[model samples]
Target: MNMATNTPLTDEQSTEAAIQRAGKTAPRVTLMDIEAVVTSEFYFTASDGVFGASNYRPISDRSGVALGLLTFCVLVLRNGFTVTGESACASPENFDAQIGCDIARKNAREKVWALEGYLLKQRLHVVE
Candidate 1:
């Protein structure tokens, strides 16, 4: 019995309805696809000495004691939305700026996935 109409639904009717629902286009996202959507990007850190391919930023005290390294990546999507990610290294010996930036950008990109997923779900709901 159909809950809404309280009518007896045959097996064929149920299968046909399920097949029809399955036919609706499903949305998907991939990391590579997300990456391509980024139009402009930049980075930030406490120190600029390692802003090269490694993208490392070092944080130190007034006494110039090496503390840690931090990397930040900001991604701006084609839609004008912005996302941010950060990477941190507690040991100065592990100074790798590029890795930090990559990590931060990845964190930021994760947010984009959530946002895009919600929008897609909303659109699908309307279609239903």
Candidate 2:
């Protein structure tokens, strides 16, 4: 904690904390493990091409190009399974491709955790 601000120090504010918490309950999934399962990753936008791009790009005085700023990530895993994730920006001024990709990747990785967790549980006979 920082005495000056009376706030907890967030030096270790990361996914590792969540992984540690999961360990307390049963078998757990780590981010690295999740990442290992991903064989390929593709990132795109609503206006990337052909389909959605044909429609009007919505706009607003405050958000500018916000409506068309939806970002998506499609992750192909080792076993031929695929998962998708998405991120959206409320304000175009704050939109960033890298940030969107990071968020979308994290979102997709979360689904892998769920899937892999279930598979592990089943293999361990922890659930019926």
Candidate 3:
């Protein structure tokens, strides 16, 4: 009778082995851990779009381009997963380009925070 040949590895063991193969020491990670590794940033314009529009690129005085309404996008990526946040912002009465960029980036981060919260809840539910 060969127990090793007859027995199958448990789910936890399998998962841990996979993680080890991936070079990660831990088999499981909490939501906070995911959030810590998760990153979010804004892009001011897109390459193939208008001359100077979108979040991946913005028109500026340096380029002799008139400053106009700017659209920005927040891209969040983690462990092969991606999420996006988008915003259109303008230089207001007192706000400058830097300020507008800050606001846009903040908005995107909020979106990512909400998504992370939802994911955390789902993971917690499954564990219980």
TM-score per model over all chains: 0.62, 0.68, 0.47
Per residue, candidate 3 scores C-alpha lDDT tens digits across 62-110 of: 3323233444655566654555444444433553556556656656656
Question: Each candidate: RMSD to true structure?
Answer: 13.9, 6.0, 14.9
User: Which stretches of candidate 2 lie above 4 Å from their native place?
Assistant: 1-26, 49-67, 126-128
Question: lDDT: which candidate is best?
Answer: 2
Of candidate 1, the 10-residue stretch with the lowest lDDT total is: 59-68
lDDT of 2 by residue, 41-106 (tens): 999876563245565544544333544588899999999999999999877778899999888987
Residue ranges of candidate 1 with Cα displaced over 4 Å: 1-25, 48-68
Q: Write the per-residue lDDT of candidate 1 for residues 83-128, one digit (tens) a residue.
A: 8877777776776878878778778877887877787788889999
> Which candidate tops TM-score?
2
Better structure of 2 and 3 per lDDT: 2
Model 3 pairs whose backbones collide = 43-55, 43-56, 44-54, 44-55, 44-56, 44-57, 45-54, 45-55, 45-56, 45-57
Pick by TM-score: 1 or 3, better one: 1
- Supply the global lDDT for candidate 2: 0.76
